[model samples]
Target: MERFNKSRVILMPCRDYDEEEIYRQLQVGIRLLGGLEGLIEKREKILLKPNLVRKAEVDRAVITHPAVMGALARILREEGYENIICGDSCGIGTASRTMAGTGMERQMEKYGIPVTDFSHPVKVDYPQGHQAKQFVIAQDALDADAIINVCKMKTHALERVTGAVKNMYGCVCGLQKAKGHTLYPNAESFARMLIDLNQLLKPRLYLMDGIVAMEGNGPTSGDPVKMGVMLLSADPIALDAVFCRLVDLDPQMVPTNVHGMQYGLGTWKTEEIEVFTPDGEVSMEEAVSRWGNPGYRVDREKYGKNIWNALKALKIFQKKPYIVEEKCRRCGICVESCPVEGKAVTFKNGRENIPVYNYRKCIRCFCCQEMCPHKAIEVK
Candidate 1:
């Protein structure tokens, strides 16, 4: 197993999303990874998989900054890499809506880049999978000549941290994501599925948007905190491991990277990684010393987590979604997002204004909470 395959993760201090500056730094990052030509080819199809999970303002740091996407596109075009397409299968909403809300629509229109909704997928087998024997992924992701994962750096209620490895979950498409949450409620099983997805995709490059990251309960619901750094890598697991280290979090506690290691994805060892910054390469100790303890972080806990997660998965125990009566707008978005057959949550008296949750039928997937526009849903 070449899990320790050496790769470079370049860190650049980028404070703002000025287009020209982003373009310049991206080039520097690419050069550190042995130049774009070394990773990509001339006139090949490239997919930019950004994390635009739901409708949100760009400054909220819920999605990849459009400036970063735009600048990367420009650099790719200049390097003769054409036919660049962007897309993601969001957890809470449609890709089109998310892209539009995250200011990606404007950039896509400006650059004449097409947005694939990732609604359609083809089933693919993964014989080595520990959790998933097979997977249904967006066709465009499979068809692309090369994939460049433009991931967001954030805290997740389940995965501890969402970085390069967890970003691939966007490939699962539509309601399958919810189904996955229902099937593998525990972080361990869920992370195995994530590792399988990444292994199947085998993206050529990974770029993390860490300029402004989310802390507390995140991936969807969390507050934004500025870390003001850009991370570029060819190894997804290594990239995630480094991120965990920088934040003074345990890489092993992060399920995606932990399962990724068990399955021979990439290195988690600090000594195995060679980190490059604008100035030059730095030792892992130096890198951690400078970037460790960002003041605020999402702590990953593992004590009795697997057992609790097992109970949650079996429905022996569940954290059901509750609607804040005052905050509920009666939009029916939560009802629509629910994957349950009869729908786990519904409107009271068919008034279409207030929401009602049927606790018994609920899968505890948290799709409603993940999708709610008004922050009206709570899991209790």
Candidate 2:
């Protein structure tokens, strides 16, 4: 297989979402990657795919920072890339609402870029895929000539950490994302499908907003923690591997990084990847010593396919989502997001009651937890 020269990843020190500072760092990162002239064309329709998981205030760290997206848009427009648009298929609501709720809509409007509707689904066939042969992605994403992934750095209930690679799942289109959780159901299988999706879309660049990241319960509904850095790479796996090192987690323990290497998507090996900063290239040890957060809260456990993952008696061995009655708004977003055919989570007792889950039918997909707006659902 022909492998990409995805060895170099740049980490820029950025403590906050200052647009000018972000623009300067982004320019430096792009220059370090041999510049945008060679990577994307001005005539191509570019899609800015951000990790807009759902609507939340910027300070909440629930979605990619609007400042980062704004800075990138400015860079692209200044470089003569006028054919640009931005969007993401969120967990529960329409893409427009998520973007608007996150303040991304206003930011894009400043740059005269329109938001793309991700409600339209288009199927693409990939017979050579290792795990999935077909994907029904957002029409805008499929139609884009090139994509620039702007992802958030955060922990995820099912995937451990949701970074560059996992962010692409947003392209799966509205309810299909919920359905995908039911289909793959496990970390490894879901990751393989993500890898296949990346292979199919082939995003041109990846930029991660790590200055402010979510820890503990995340991808949504987590506390904001500062990592004080921004990351850039053409390789999603390598970018995510660097994320792992900074958080003091083992890259091999992440299913996407492991399968990403096995399937020739990108390399996570410390020896194979080179990390850079404004000063120069640094050893992984030095990089970790300078920036690594040993105290960072994230799931570092290795997930494997076993009978215990399915059996109700062995539920302790598995992470199951439960409703926290105090925080639940009883809006039923959790029940609505549950993809199980018969509805694994439902307001069986009454509409006035908090939604309940049938453990026997639950797939442990964390859909309910992920879509819960009030931080009412927790996995344990």
Candidate 3:
């Protein structure tokens, strides 16, 4: 395995404002990487894996924009690459539901592309040995001739920023994703796991859908900012570094970048990276300036100290669930999901059956947040 430097990042300015025009720009970006000819052999089965985190409208900036996928599929087809498919596993639901709700199925149908559920998984080993012994990956992803990972640029609750590298986690399948979180509970460990996964299942090409990126608290709820730029790279780590720089975020602060550099995944320093723009030539500073900072506050000292204290005061770390009385429908889902021996969450006798959270034994895993159908649970 060879290490990738910053020189590998290719940033292409999308002059086209409309969807069709944007697709043309995407074709130019891929052309710089030897086009889809060599990358995708004629008639080879190709999987266009996009980040469908949840079933949200494209305008909401939660999942990968269907237009982007539509554009990519069209380009690939033009190059004589047939047998195209699109799929991903959403966090809170099944792939089929996510595809239907997000209108990805319609997009695929428009392009005559097939949609497959990446739910059935098979175990694969990581001989390099970064974190876990092996990972369970969706069989469809593994069987594809090549995977074109189209990831949305967004900030994540656990990983800070989720880009090309983080997007590959979709290959792990659906419910199995929760199990990975359970295995690597902490942020740093989880990042290491992602690095290992990326190495094991390396995609043939990587593209960052930065036209509209999510900032602040994201991968779910966040403000959508128009970045007006797209990036392509053979190296996932380098592409992520470029994305962090464009947003004025420190790549070192991103756990995946840090661990990836340490393990020979990609470069962390900006000076060593050589950036190529669309119009033949442009200064790195000029291209980066076009992407204005999203103004995200990262309190390093406070966050670091708090995490350390929380781990140290494990037993005393109270997980309080503040129920919104107005929103509570007297449902007992919280009580049912509580794993504590003494039943930390219990329904009150006569008061709207309001469930009480006992902080003493709660693990703070936020399972209550996932199980609540009415969005009534808030952990603090």
Candidate 4:
């Protein structure tokens, strides 16, 4: 019996002005890997899976940039690779809602790419296991001959950073995502589950949209920074390593990357890997210095201040909602989304208003944070 060889990763900087130029640069990177022709056979069905986490605008850095998808699809079409479809199963909601809320539907129409909802799913067993016995993946994702994983470069509250490796979680289909969270419970276990899922799916190609990246508390509500870079790879682990380095993050600290290497997914150490750029070649250190890490840095002063406030406002500020009033619509969705058995969050007025959260009973699962329709909730 023969062993499967590890995949290769290609890195490129996107200093281009617009979408077409960025796409062309990505094409250059892919060409280094024997081009898309080798990856996509003639008349084979291809699935372009992007990181559409929830129904949020594209510019918010919550999902993959439509421009990147359009560019990749255009390049595929030119190469005679038809039967392309765009799809994703979100974190806690339906793909349809994510598509509509994120304006991905409009992008799909513009590119003439069919948007698929991976709703009806099938179970796939993994013989060599790290955590899970089987996963319920969307049938279309499993059946496709080729899958192009398009992921947004963003920070995650749990996994640290969600990139090429983490995007494969979308393949789980629907609410199975939330269920996976419940099953794994902790970040370390959840990351192990992700590695197992990636091994099972084995996407043909992976692309990271780093032109604009999310920093701080993300994968959703983070500040968008201009990274002006994009990455392509067949090896998800290698790509994640490069992403980590680009952001000045220790790859070992990232749960997904650490577990991925342990599971024989790909290499995490920068010393063993080689990177090829679109123009003049540069080291991972230089790229990170130029681009800057998008992960959050804790403010010691702010932490001290919050502690003082918690002590001072013992009643109201004990566990008060640190709402981003700018982002808050006061829709009271968080109040309703709270799963407290005793109705911890109750309306202040007769009409819909931001409900006060009971600090003692708050599970801190961020279910309220995850389900907030208005993106209002935050933990201090």
Candidate 5:
């Protein structure tokens, strides 16, 4: 825990997803973090975990850019690390399909990195966990000596911002991820569980692709807005804190950032983080001044246990997901993705009819919103 007393984060400006450019910038960022030699062994089994939420093109900014992943793989291979794999559990479909859809499968083939659906869930007990004492982790993750989290920067309906910390939720195999919402329905509890998972897995490094980030309603369904930045760090919390700063969001308002500090995952306190660029060490304020997007469309309101959340009967007062009848494709993915008992969303009218949400059963987990392929569901 004391190792997190002071954390270093490297922030670099990236205009686009040009493979060569990303490779060069990543090389500098890794070097700034004292290189991977001292941290990861050359022969150690490594897992390059990317945020493959679901099937979508790279331009959508829904998942981590394949170019970033390929560049990281190329760098590792250059470092004499031949044993490497890339994997993630997609939110709504097979990992293979999502990988192919996002052009990640092609990138992996180019780098000779095997892709896993993160199959074979293994029960791992973590008594030290403050929120979750045990977890069912993917076998690939459990076997890896080190994990390099390659996550995307996007707004999330549940967590506000899904960056380095929340990215690890994909470590939970397939349907278990949906079930997790049932276990930890709210942002605070869910974030505590995420902190526990990070503490348990202890990924070697965290990298965020922020050149183009999703905004409005995101994590999966949202519009892409160019932010022109990339972030890297050993501490997920500090890395995410820098992400918060770039979007003009208060890091303290993010549940993961708050619980991460309390549970010793890493520090979000501005004083405890050392943010820098290739020029020299710079203040968080300076980092924002250079690449910050004060106009970025993210929920900046403080999410406390207030009347808004407490008054469930007043559904109109809360931020709940509603279907845009015109956009609804009647795919029933929302119905299938709902983790609540008896299903919060169902085809109440008929199989051919649009699914309806029983708000009474809805946990406001936003699984329906997150998994909706069409831009039908939006929380307002």
Candidate 6:
């Protein structure tokens, strides 16, 4: 509603997650936003929602870097805010194990903070939504006194780039994320739904771990590239718009940001965005030229809606998941996460525990591809 301070964003140069260096940088970034003095009062419980998407090491950049988050937590602790907890509803397993695997739990535990699973969720109604009318949101998302959405900068197969706005999708709890994909199958429709979710969650602040970000096909399944910058924002839409610019991509092509503007989420125009760094306020163009990725971007399928819808009806998009037998550990997670009523991918093919996908029944949501920890499932 406030328009993310008219697209004002703070950019801080951070090359690594070294304990001391990152702590100082985070302080500077927070101070740029008026520090905790203006934002949070002492003793207020703050929820740190980091990107713990399917439990990968921080080096992979699939989730927010643990060191970045830990340092921020410590900084907040020193700022007189002691009650803190890190949480997310992971894709496949419980939140506790995912936190442990991604190396977030150890850092958080160091600061007397507990990692809780947003497992138990409550249903919410959104009559004012553009495409989404109702949702089941994580109770922790609703219960937190304030939410600082700590997101990883990455490419998403569905939404193109996964940034601050897309990170809140984790607030919907586990498999329900799959249900969301199934409910709103088209990219435009799903992006609008994400806007609805963001409005409901209403994160007060946004922070990004861009020291190393995932490029190409990601969110999971991509290579990490050195971007070496941390970002802070009051508005996610504007934050994402700046990010799209940094990556040399058109922000209008990013669906969340496109729909975000229509929903009054935040500004999507980079030209209108006011960027700041230690050197002082910088123009968006200068910021991009100085600290931007010209050659890196997420993969996006090129097909107009009419063409895509035509092919989609015929199931001709052909981006269906196929398991690599050797890489497959027969975990059955893909089978479990499928939102189809009869289960699109099944273990009923009767070959020990290996699963098979009946592509005809599949919705092509890539839930299987996204959840596979072993990288056994590949979509073509």
Which parts of model 1 are misplaced by more than 4 Å? 1-5, 305-326, 342-364, 378-380
Who is ahead in TM-score, 1 or 2?
A: 2
Better of 4 and 6 by TM-score: 6
* Candidate 2: segments with Cα more than 4 A from true spot: 1-6, 303-316
Sliding window of 10 residues with minimal summed lDDT for model 6: 1-10
Q: Write the per-residue lDDT of candidate 3 for residues 1-380, one digit (tens) a residue.
A: 13233446678665433678678778777776656675668867888899877666677677787778878888887787778888776665766677685566777888888877787789888777598778989998888878889998887655668899889888887667767866775567888998998787778788888788887546655567778777888778878988888877778888899898888777767776667765654555776776546464321222446777776467454334566767788777667655455666777565566787776655554445444556576544
Candidate 5 positional error at 232, Å = 0.2
Q: After superposition, how far is residue 276 of candidate 2 from its true place, in Å?
A: 0.8
* Candidate numbers sorted by lDDT from highest down: 5, 2, 6, 1, 4, 3
Supply candidate 1's per-residue lDDT for 252: 81
- Model 4: residue 55 alpha-carbon error in angstroms: 1.9
lDDT of 5 by residue, 1-380 (tens): 23334699999778898889899988998888888996799889999999989888889899999889989999998899999988888897767778885668888888888998888899888998889988989999989999999999999998899999999999999888988899998888999999999989999999999999999989888899999888999999999999998899999989999999988888888898998787778998898898999999999976455776666445556679999998998988898899998998999999777888898788899999999999899998
By TM-score, the candidates rank as: 5, 2, 6, 1, 3, 4
Task: Give one digit per residue, the lDDT tens place, for model 2 in 193-300.
Answer: 999999999998999999999999887988899998999988889899999999999999899999998998888988888888877888889989988898889998
Better of 2 and 4 by TM-score: 2
How close is every model to the real structure, measured as TM-score?
0.88, 0.95, 0.83, 0.82, 0.96, 0.92
On lDDT, the leading prediction is 5
Could you say which candidate leads in TM-score? 5
Q: Over the full model, what C-alpha lDDT does candidate 2 score relative to the true structure?
A: 0.88
Number of clashing pairs, model 3? 3
Q: RMSD in Å for candidate 2, one decimal?
A: 2.1
User: Please, what is the whole-model Cα lDDT of each candidate in the order they appear?
Assistant: 0.80, 0.88, 0.73, 0.73, 0.89, 0.83
lDDT for position 63 in model 5 = 90
Write model 4 residue lDDT over 1-380, tens digit each, in one string. 01124345566667643777877887788887778877778788889999877777777778888778778887887778768887788765666677774556776777678887888799888878698888989998998888899998887756667898889888886657656765775567888898988888778889999888887656576678878888888778888888878776778888788899888888888765666676655666766676655444411122235668566445443323456757767776666555566655657554344566666665444546656656576655
For residue 117, give model 3's deviation from the true position in Å: 1.1
